[model samples]
Target: MQIAKVRGTVVSTHKEASLRGAKLLLLQYIDEEGRLLPKYEVAADQVGAGVEEWVLVTRGSAARQVEGNQTRPLDALVVAIIDTVSIDNRVLYSKKDQDRK
Candidate 1:
């Protein structure tokens, strides 16, 4: 799994039948220090994360392993909406702090 920022939503009117009702988000990968990377991807949203929120994402085959996503065609999936991220007792990102920005 990796941390990423929800940049925006992806709307596809001609996608596969199984992905019709699924919510897809555009994510920009973030490093451990909470800096954004140049890489970007679209992920299935099971956690209802909003734009600008930090989320935990799983990619590749593991993305399809999440419950209802087993039969869907997904290369990535948002597994959790991040509330706080810390390392070495130092807070790197906090939902409350972000909201105040």
Candidate 2:
């Protein structure tokens, strides 16, 4: 699992049958300090995350499993809303910061 910032939402009229009714969100991989990391990709939303939300994402087979399906074509999934993130006892990102920004 990794942390990412939700960039936006994806709308698809056509997709795998298993993916129907699933929310797709664009996620930007980020560092511990909450800076954007190198890669960005779309993910299935299992936890109802919204745009610009900092989310915890699971990857690979684990991601698909979290959605309660094993055969779905998914590489990532937003599993949680991060309330706070700390590094070296320093707060990096938090819901409070989001509210302030």
Best by lDDT: 1
Candidate 1 structure lDDT: 0.92
RMSD of each: 1.1, 1.6
**How displaced is residue 61 in candidate 1, in Å?**
1.8
Q: Which lDDT tens digits does candidate 2 get at residues 1-101?
A: 89999998789887788888778898999888788887988888888887778899988877778536567888888889999998888887888878888
Report lDDT (CA) for all predictions.
Answer: 0.92, 0.85
Output the lDDT of residue 100, model 1. 98
- Number of clashing pairs per prediction, in order: 0, 0
lDDT of each residue in 33-81, candidate 1, tens digit only: 7789999999999889999999999989988987788899899999999
Model 2 TM-score on a 0 to 1 scale: 0.87
Quote the positional error of residue 28 for candidate 1 in Å.
Answer: 0.3
Give the runs in model 2 whose Cα sits over 4 Å from its true position: none
Mind sharing the TM-score for model 1?
0.92
True-structure RMSD for candidate 1: 1.1
